[model samples]
Target: MLDFHTLAEFSRANCVSICAFLVPANLLATVLTIILTALHRPLHQIWQAAGFASIFALIMVMHVYSWFAIGVVMLPTYILLWLAITCLLANLIAILWRRRFVNTPSLSNNA
Candidate 1:
């Protein structure tokens, strides 16, 4: 099992590869989930849970107590981030369609 420092060093050495791309992407997904939740979207609980899991992993890593293989840790992060972003986009599109076409009045409908 690698210590956090060792893992950090390894990640730094390969920063241009997967770690560099994923860390920012995960963080961005977390932020997007939080934003969507704040807006009272459909992904409230799922986003909260995924965000909590990521935060827990990040805290564990920061404290040097994380023991999972890097791939093990990263794979779930990627999956959850992708899921959250996809759900958020779908919810946004649904809301926009409802507001523009379903809820709002149109001249054609009046005619």
Candidate 2:
């Protein structure tokens, strides 16, 4: 099995490429989701955007994990991991909230 050292080395070697793709991807996904939310767009549309954001968040999580595996616990790494987790959890909560509460009809109107 591949060890943490090996994974860390691999991540380090490809750090430039990883950042090139992930930086822009994460930025774009996050911006789009925020814009969609601000615009009060449809729930389905927001959900789709959040889905993409979650994918990027998962990738960030893996990248952070790789660094952590090598015992590199710097502030930047910690912030990145925190951002990823926050994005993922926020998206999940937003989705669940929309499904469970936003879509439900009020009972007072039935009187």
Candidate 3:
């Protein structure tokens, strides 16, 4: 397993290349999913929300890890990471709750 410091150094060294790949890839996939869902309205909503939550959580985790790797261990970073984790867990719970109990027909009719 690579340490945080090593990962940070690698990220700094290949910042441009990493951004070029990660940013565009994430954007493209999100756009494609949105487009597909818009076109196919009957697609399950839970799947979409779950996918989004998972992606968001992954991004937050990556950010926290990167901050640790970059030698910027400070109070603000700690707070931000704590918030991110909390939000991620909340979103995950929401997704699970909606999956288990929320009815799509009732929600659609209500809306």
Which candidate tops TM-score? Answer: 2
Worst-scoring 10-residue span by lDDT in model 3: 34-43
Q: Write the per-residue lDDT of candidate 3 for residues 1-111, one digit (tens) a residue.
A: 769667666765674665555454444444444454444433466467447645754664576578676587878557646655654565455455545454445566677
Question: What is candidate 1's CA lDDT for residue 38?
Answer: 51
- How well does model 1 score by local distance difference test? 0.49
Question: How do the predictions measure up, each by TM-score?
Answer: 0.33, 0.68, 0.47
What tens digits encode model 1's per-residue C-alpha lDDT throughout 66-100? 22434345665455445545544544554444345
**Descending-lDDT candidate ranking:** 2, 3, 1
Clashing pairs in 1: none
> What local lDDT score does residue 60 receive in model 3, on the 0 to 100 scale?
46
Clashing pairs in 2: none
How do the residues 1-111 of candidate 2 rate in per-residue lDDT, one tens digit apiece?
Answer: 869677677777797787678767776786777677666678898799899999998988888888877788899888878878877877777666556655667699778
Model 1: ten consecutive residues of lowest lDDT: 60-69
Model 3 TM-score, all chains together = 0.47
Residue 53 accuracy (lDDT) in model 1: 41
